[model samples]
Target: MGRKLLSLLLFASLATATPAAAAPTAAPQPPTELVTGLSLPWATSFLPDGQSALMTERNSFRVSRVTLDGTRTTVGTVPNSVTTNGEGGLMGIAVSPTWNGTSDQAVYLFHTSTDGGQTQNRVVRMDFDGTTLSNRTVIVSGIRSNTFHNGGQLKFGPDGFLYAGTGDAQDTSTSQNDSSLNGKILRFTTSGQPAPGNPFGTLVYSKGHRNPQGLAWDSAGRMWSAELGDTQFDELNLIVSGHNYGWPICQGSCSTPGMDNPKRTWTTAEASPSSLAIVDDTAYVAALRGQRLWRVELNGENAGATQAYFTNTFGRLRSIVQVPGASAIWISTSNTNGDKLLRSVIQ
Candidate 1:
């Protein structure tokens, strides 16, 4: 689609967007470990219940159920997931909030598969019967992939649409090219088609993303994403359908006419953020290279004061999940032998 067409689509979509988020009322809490000793876990998704969560391992291709007591049960592995040869493999997992152990058991996974010399990433759906993941169903496919910038973030939006965050796959042109699926946040139904009422009449929900790895929705149902930049700035963006984020042409604070400014941005060294979770009202971003968790206070869709926690204490935090019904969250470490899970305990 042309730039003007996209802008018009976005304007139409924005006409229905709820007013900016209400004044957030979240207080920061410290995090603690709940489990330890796992291989390259990529993401953690909480079950509808408060305790157990489905956790995905990158190279292992395994999904395990972990509880507050640190006990874990093997859910299953995605058979065709490529090993993490160059940051590509079984990456993100999203469990449906409505999944019942009986008939509706559904879990979605994003993995990279070998496509000759190049790699292709896809999101597949599997049935989780509280024990094993069966009935593999490939939902979305043919997303071109490279070694780096394979954005693998997935979350179910409040409107019950499955949202997948994709990278530009190291090709900057695709970010601005609406025809390409790379560097975009896509919305689809559980059946894997474009969600009804999506802007641009396609799966592409928002475009012009560089390497978006984290996605979460706030209480007001507004979507937010954490994206990595080339060299200068990393962004925390409030995602709006059909809006342009200005990846290659404009990094941070670009005065480009139609490009959207991020709610917040940090230097690359401080926030190679991956996987975000909203707790209370704050958006907690797990910083991979920064080795910390960032707390961004939200006020009407914009960010206020920010804080960093667990700096360098846990090597390369990968995913953070808000403990359901609690003010604390679960933090996972990406350190080689040091990789472990921690939970917060009020002091």
Candidate 2:
């Protein structure tokens, strides 16, 4: 072959060999089942040594220690102030950020409760002795609630601030009202006080959301939220301080006049995103109604190259947590009526 022809052929081959920046085509190895027999598992927290996890059951209001071998023992039941209903009950839980045999170490929980005939969401801190719970205290409360759209996701940000995502309590207008804690991501100290120098001088960190179910922070300390939209847009947002994410006004994109658009949006069928975990530069979204795991590459909050996996492997994916020092993702299956947990090892 002529030298010029050979060079052209080599370039063409290289182009064909490179993968496109869309859905990953390489069939990831089938995920191995980790544990089964869980009743609508909601959230998971890794132990300090990463061998065990604490998982919450939604309707049962039960929190249990799940070992790597799939053995489960009930730690304790979350204090219930109201009856468990659709999408209400024990929701999110996180271990104390400063938990190193400290006296103040506790497991924090976020759930919906009924008070005076009005449903409300609250955060409570419960002391854990590795076997049971003692000394439960309400950390923060007064979040509007309803049968659905009770945004219940909590995590400690790298800045040591306790962040909670709240829903609009089925009232679309509340998302835009600054005075209402509903439909916003709240930032507060461990003592449940609003962080000093908040943008609004209150617990409201950012406003204008529908039902935000996922909260995650990247290594750069940037927060991202996954929200369920009303029959239109399911959004993934790069949460910024004091920025408004238009809910009823704007569904998707940046078309709405004073609101920030999502980094990416999907149809409700494609992603009813429940929870998210950012590993390296990739954001993995756990889908509930969509029943899939979405992988979105992150370029400084702006998303690129999206992919989906686990189409029908698990009925409903509730949460995804990265296993530290391992190339695996621990996924909670909401086969509540069925009960199962899965661990996905990315190949």
Candidate 3:
């Protein structure tokens, strides 16, 4: 899509978004270890049956099928994945919401790889048949990647489209560039084309992000994101299509017009939030530096005060997703030293 045309379409979509409605909130119980002896597990997406979930290991590039009862099986390693030696590697997996054992068995993944030996990030599709993965096909590719800030988080929104958060690839310029895919939240079709009705004619749903890693939707279908900041602050944002989140221009909150401020902000020491999950209208953020789970209640398009859970008890919390059929959540450790998956009940 041409930059000028894309810009016009993006702004057009912006004016069409409606305000979000709030949902209920709850407190989560202390987490208990479910699966141990894992590597750097980065993301988790449960199968439609709710009996098991598919998880990704960053440095190892291994995909594992983990049962609700803690049984873990190595499904397959993603092909051509490479670690950036900092943060880039195999990351983000989303099981198709309509996946069935027989036919509609699509699953998606986001990872760092080399295309013609040039480092980039990609979104790929594979088929899972309750046992193994096959038919690997690159759905979306050519997003710039670096050692760190290669934003890698994928989730299927309630609208039935795949959403991916891409980092600025350490190039601050890319976040503000409408033509670049980096530093943006992108919407895509099952076949990897830009999703229809996207604000931009391209895949970009929103731009000007630093390193957005967490993506989730509330009961009202409002999109929210958790982003890692450069030095001072981290952010939780209520995502609106075609919005521009201040990045290099503004870290947390600024008075700048045309740049949206975060709904909530935290000091880097308190929250290097890597992943987010929404349950009962409450936002649960997995903190990497603070080593805890931070909860923020959703109040319509705004957020409430923050609370911390299991502080310093878990080492470098990474992924957190609500259990498919229960009022519980599954979390993963990212320390890479015999990490584990945990489950927590919400009350």
Candidate 4:
């Protein structure tokens, strides 16, 4: 069977027992803009104080800390090692999870740079001295790189290890190669060693992804990933340990043997998911080409209801980060083509 037909059949089998319900629609509420005038913001992470956030701009290789009062300051440059091309550059940033009551902690970054023959992806750590970055070190490197499909998103999982989302670098076969780090979610120690008790007992936690830009865990510690599809079928998946997500072989919902299926899939026109944040049972996905935010309700392992918000008000929503203890969310604008950073207060 064709890929799409097989996917539909699999989804039908999964949801066959339940009656079809109407797709959830977001309640109409005006979005209050918190800040503006940012250039191609890629990611956002809250400072330990909870009132400020650090954001990364893709093309500029600049990182800035913005306060709730609307002030912005440059934390530091991400080093001139990055080569800014189509979809590659300074992409993901995360503050050290051990940043409580200490000045020695740092923020981590994932970016693409040129080696000798081809571009490469590397992860670097930078010390934050309350005002600027101090010592910087490249902790991980040698991942596949290209002008496009350079998946660059990083997060610290509850397991106290750093998790990084990597793209296929436009090479489809790389997704299934165990030796290649491209097109996979890599789990490693804070010092960049492969984390203990990994599925492969190595850095690779899961494989067979196209371009996974979203990585977030629920309150139950279940890891979830949002992937950008090639031509159709953007997906939200419950990331299983050591399972293949079937990128080239299967796109969205999978019926093929030995492959995990997505919990939910949407037409690429409706959802070009980039970044995701989970609060309680709701998974908020940031859409880029779709130009909206998808709020998907999850009950255990099943998708419950889905809704879309901010339909063209903010242009391309590149990334969303929920405030640790607040009701507000920080959304980065993909003005890489033309947008701005926006802070959304859920009303």
Best by TM-score: 3
Cα-based lDDT for every prediction: 0.85, 0.83, 0.93, 0.84
Q: What is the C-alpha lDDT profile of model 3 across 190-280, one tens digit per residue?
A: 9988899999889999998999999999989999999999999999999999999998899999988999999999999999999999988
As for TM-score, the candidate ahead, 2 or 4, is 2
Give one digit per residue, the lDDT tens place, for model 4 in 224-258.
99999999899999997899999889999868998
Model 1's alpha-carbon lDDT is 0.85
What would the per-residue lDDT of candidate 1 be over residues 1-347, giving only the tens digit for each residue?
99999999899778656456454445445655577788778888888876789999888888999987889899888877786467778888889989887878999988897544555898889999888888888888878778888898888888988999899998999999888889999999988899988888888999999999989988888889999988999999999999999988899778999999999999989999888887655788989889888889888789988988778877898887877787777878887565788886422
In terms of lDDT, the poorest run of 10 residues in model 2 is 20-29
* After superposition, candidate 3 runs with Cα above 4 Å error: 1-25
In each prediction, how many residue pairs overlap at the backbone (N, C-alpha, C within less than 3 A)?
Answer: 7, 1, 1, 2
Error (Å) of candidate 1 at residue 114 is: 4.3
For candidate 2, the TM-score is 0.89
TM-score, predicted candidate 4 vs. hidden true structure: 0.89
Candidate 1 residue runs with Cα over 4 Å from true position: 1-30, 114-118, 345-347
RMSD of 1: 12.3
Question: What shift in Å separates residue 35 of candidate 1 from its native position after superposition?
Answer: 1.1
Question: RMSD per prediction, one decimal?
Answer: 12.3, 4.0, 13.0, 10.7
lDDT, residue 264, candidate 3: 98
Off by over 4 Å in 4: 1-29, 100-103, 115-118
